[model samples]
Target: MASTVCGWCGDRTHMTMVTDLYQLPEGLWPTKGYSATPDRDLPVWMAAFRCPNENCQRLSIGWAPLHRAKMGPTKDLFLREQLNWEPTQIRRPAFPDVPKEIADTASEAHACLSIGAARGAVALARAVVEATAKAKGITMHGIAPKIAAMREQDIISPLTEQTSHQIRKDGNSIAHGDIGEELMSLDDAAAILEFMDALLDEVFQRPAKLTRLSERGTQQAPGGSADGATPVQGGADFSTPH
Candidate 1:
């Protein structure tokens, strides 16, 4: 069994090995299973993996290949490489609290990041911010205006507004081709993604959490007051201890 992230459920769990490491057929090996050819010293293989999550016991697959190196006549080589394994080994994060439209755009941005399209991710990060603003009923024409409006409405804090403006500028540069994907570093992509998550959390998740808290506070038990106290016939110091 191997551990990998389930792409479907997005869980970090074990995957039961569904098959032994099977060597690729010689007939199909020529095309390298419709992918790039393997190195001369490496051979292709396939394996099946099934998720252990009962609700998500779906099957996934991957390709495994062994790399051989010859050091001496008596030397034996042993190393294996697997591509596109189950669990995707990449995060496809979910912004459940964000509005559906904004969440979808953010997901695409994350997909680009996971695939190493750093500039595309950054460009789309800007789009996500715009979508979030629109979801909040902000009708400004640009990210800067929208951010300023959000600050005015108390939708975002002053510090966040300042940082968001900077992100908007970076996103604009990337979107207009001023910064190319090859020029964007992985670190930059990661940092921008973190900011996106934080912004979404503040705008959506926090508000939703507060609403839930308010609803709970207003809820009343059957035959009891909203404050959770039940009336007693005698009413002699019936209050519960704090």
Candidate 2:
């Protein structure tokens, strides 16, 4: 009787159609008055709904038996039409705390991946590397070159050519490859994410320069103690023989 625009089509109002008792399968029809069936039957109680939109006259045709679905608040979580169909509930996730360094690496790795959804992971790794380098007073540009220089000066260890090669390869992939081309499986994505984070930790995280018990040592503590130590109480040099 009343006209209401279809949510999907926007141009046409929803219309309902009804079927005669003979039209329905014998056993499926309600035994009592034609109107005795439940609300769900009301739809089937009649014919399916059709979109009024002339251009997109989509039909809402389906076989749904009488049933009840628990509905929830329609304000924030639920859609209006959903109330007419099936009910659903919403829940929020309980997020855990993440370490700053790990968070940074993940952000960087995410930025580096062009293929698939792994871009986020790559960006995280890159962010971690860049941030850590900056904190260590290292240059962000020409990272491989900077790393090489540090290796040569014995500032960093185990800086193999492989590391540089991987960075270049990964960089090229992220920069030039089609994002949709190389969609990796969940396992592969996880592995790569782990690798990225581990690599950042391995190379970028400067180890706490062996914080010695006392600064007065025979030889400068191997990694050249960065933590400046002070003389023992009474200005007594711990290095002096008793």
Number of clashing pairs per prediction, in order:
2, 31
Alpha-carbon shift of residue 107 in model 2 (angstroms): 6.7
Candidate 1 lDDT over residue span 176-215, tens digit each: 7786544665457767877887788788977786565555
RMSD of 2: 20.9
Which pairs of residues clash in candidate 1, taking residues 3 or more apart in a chain or in different chains?
Answer: 5-87, 6-87
Q: Where in model 2 is the C-alpha error above 4 Å?
A: 1-116, 159-161, 164-168, 176-180, 203-206, 209-242
On the 0 to 100 scale, the lDDT of residue 97 in model 1 is: 84
RMSD of each: 9.2, 20.9
lDDT of 2 by residue, 1-242 (tens): 21233444433243443322112354555444566543443222223455566776655432322222534532212212212211111111111123455554455454333222344544344444445445556774765665555466555456433453354445445555545655433234445555554444444432221123343442444555454354333344335321
Compare the candidates by TM-score and give the number of the best one.
Answer: 1
Off by over 4 Å in 1: 1-88, 180-182, 220-242
